[model samples]
Target: MLFPYLLKVSLLLGVLTLGYRWMVQFETYSKFNRLLLWLNVLAAWSLPLIPLPNWGPTRIQAEFHQSIPKIAQAAPAVKHKIAAYNPAPTVVSHQRLSSLNQKLKSLHVMQWLLVVYISGVLVLASHFFYQVGGLVWVLLRSPKEKSDRRVVFVRNLRSNSPYSFFQWIIVNPEKHQPGELQHIIAHETEHALQWHSLDLLLAELQRIVLWFNPFAWFHQKLVQANLEYLADRAVLDGGFERKQYQYSLLNAILCTTEVPLTTSFAQSLLKNRIKMMNKKPSHYLAWGKYALLLAVLYVSSAFVAPYTLTLVKLPPSILRPALKTLATNDKVNFKEVSSKILSLGPSKAESLIEELKKKTPETTKAIQPSRSKWVIKKNDALFWVISPLATLDDINEIRNEVKSFDAELNINSIEYDPLQSFIARITVHVNVKSGSSSTAKEGTDRYSPMKGESGYLTKSGSLGTGSVPNELEKQLQMDYEKALALSKKNEPYYFETRLMEKITALGSSSSHAFDKNTLNGAAAESAFRYDGVGKSTDNFLKLEPEHRNSELYLNSKPATFTELNSLSFDLVRSIKIIRDARGKKYMIVYTN
Candidate 1:
């Protein structure tokens, strides 16, 4: 969240700085105009901080609405249909799944980057506060005498160049006569009187937060320069002779201070300050440049920075909830069977019927007073209640009665024995009478677990690959082949037990074991570092028992001891460990 705002603020500051640079080059504006420019720069930096109102009902919202499915809109009825088949699972598109995965990964990366960026901000802010503390210490301990109610004069300070910080003016009195020193005090007095310290503090704080933005540094310089110009103008207006002030400015030598908040009397860039003092006032038409600033802000608000953010409210997808129960009929009747097997007295039977009707009015409209098709054995406590309710409410009610034993009610939908009904069947009515001739044959199984060419399930029962897309299959196959090949080549083929023991004993530095000087150049340099041979750099050997590289291969392939060929130590004619010209080590076991 902060990152996005930082980016926007940086962009605004950069544009504002460019505009200020271009306009200031062509005009000698008054202090008021410069102040306006400074405030606009600050405002541009703060634009991203303002909260934007959500702009709902954009074109994107319309696209989102079109993309989601609506449950009320039923799938069109098929011309040629088959009944008593299980429903297939809905297929999710790969594009949708891929996008979701990418978003999750991006969220993780953003979280890590946010941590790093905030750490940098804290470090920069700490450094900034340290500078402020150093300046405050200097202000407190320096020798000072009261100049007036609003100002103080500091003497014997390390700052050779006269400067003002808040209410205190520091100058080395020994360097100038009383008349020249009074001029210096008046110039420093102007800065303190105007409260220029507040502006410098704001600029310094902005720099600490946006240390990475180059334009922030530029803005700070411009602000400080403008404040100096304002101070110079104020001094001249206070009755200082122009020629004498100009002579004093040229002869002044600056002793730089660490604190940027102070208004230094003899700062570098003296020439620009002198030119600003003598330059004629800008023409009234010069104010036209400000109109360009307004235009830039308008463009930014319209395209770059939106103040109004609309949020679109979309209907939830059909998949968000379970399939809604469709009402099959306006009313249904439940009839009690012959009171033989399960005779609840007439009172209890009537009460149970009333309870059922109250709980599920959509499924149970009335209880028939006549005998039902299902008959019960006399004296039995449970019996079937033939029902004309087939909606989802009826199904749920029947299930609840069985589980809770709510009342002595049984229906044909329930099976008495285990495994009696493992699969459920639904009966839906659809008219198969078409005016045109049909290709479907009579007495055909339309769902025989085979694929058909007509794109619809045929009498032979084929519906071509269901929903498995062809492109996805091809991509999966290609990836599977590559993985299979990689799996084979990455596995090493190890030699037999005795050869392995010999190789292990040989170690990474065989020359050290044999007290020989065969290892030279690159090999000699790495002789002591036996570990991390095959791990860090690929295609290298690590004969040391504790250290092994993952990329190290046995005869160009990774191998476990079990994968080695059976061989006896006596059958091995020679054992040689050699480092090739490229510094790759190879272990060879040759048979007689």
Candidate 2:
């Protein structure tokens, strides 16, 4: 983020510099040049500082994907492949987690760079203020004399230098002959009347803030040179001899001593000043060159301007309807239910689910057979007898209604019970509120095949319904409970206690919770941004660019953590917690 901001600043600087160069090349009017330079300099420093809309160009949101795993069962004669999809855990030992946290606390190269840059700015700013104070002191000590009604000159100063400090023309009479003093007064007066001192002050402030930028120094020199050119033109325009003025300037270079906040009459770079005085005057057409400044500013504005995006999220409540629908079906398949819910989006799915839930009088109970199946049939081949008194035509209508709810339900056979007249052996299921109101009891034995020596027997000779012993079942239950507890302990949320406590203390809900000591970079970021908790950390990184820090490790190898979207969440396990030293709310994620 810092890099991008700096790059934009640099581009603005380049564009303005190019404009200045173009104006200088054509010898455009000095006053217009001064205006262009000042405007561009201020624009370059300030455009990036202006807070643009952060939501537009920089907003990032987590994507939602269906979590249900797909299952496809094949027939007996065909080969079948079953793959169970699970979110695998990443394990990090206790010792390594401690080491990672310690490593995270160490200062990075960018941090050191900021420290050094800030130190330079402080030093330069102090010196600029000191120079301003020195100019004030010189004004207090020097004797003031009225040269004319329009000019006020300060004479007999300890420093023999001639300079202007904000409407006051300060010069030593003893150092210059009467003729040379006349030219010097004229030069210094041009600086005072035109308010060149203010330009110098602005340049000084820019230097202090951008002390590390060589372009800033170059820009200051350009402004200073332009001021001198304007002053030289004034003296020449006042009818001073070019040769005599040139000699005075050359003579005063050695004795010239001016502070940052003042404009001096004589200084180095006499060649550029003399060259400008000798050059032919620029044409009226060249004045049109100032138009480029406007273009440059426009470009800079477009470059720094931000864009916006509205984040979208689906609520978890929408899944309840689909879950209920799956519960009512004989074959409970999560993959199909989840797909249906997601297809309708969160709000629509939720509304539809609610309507479906309202139609059902009570929750559907799971099937608990009195005796297990002797030979289990495929889920598609099996059917449940919801109504025994309904006719064939009624069965067909009911089947269509159930199929409308979920196309996966297949009803192929219908038969009448041999002993009970008008009783049917057909399976036709529909919603209770769909006008046809024959009710079936919950947990009824819908799948029962008679055991005989010669009928529907497997190759094993007898149809065997397997059962676990009572003690073995109890042991399996205990193992399952222990495994669940251990898995919970390893989740990213498990180690977020201390961080969450600190966040709560700050009285901010925007803070992200990550198990830095256990979860890896990708997993930590996912937890921080989209953990189904109250607040999300999606926009956290954009809040504070300089303080946004993350360290990622893939298979124990160090990796770059740029954006959360680019990361693979499954590979992350352990993360290191890092707190921002700056007093703002910022979080750092480290993953392994």
Q: Whole-model lDDT, candidate 1?
A: 0.48
- lDDT accuracy of residue 119 in candidate 1: 84
User: For candidate 2, what is the lDDT?
Assistant: 0.52
Deviation in Å, model 2, residue 18 alpha carbon:
3.5
> Could you estimate the TM-score for every candidate?
0.43, 0.43
C-alpha RMSD of each candidate structure in angstroms: 28.3, 29.9
- Which number leads on lDDT? 2
Badly placed stretches (over 4 Å) of model 2 are: 1-7, 49-105, 108-110, 147-151, 308-592
For model 1, the stretches where C-alpha displacement exceeds 4 angstroms are 49-108, 254-258, 307-592
> How far out, in Å, is residue 184 in model 1?
1.7
Q: Tell me how far candidate 1 lies from the true structure as C-alpha RMSD in angstroms.
A: 28.3
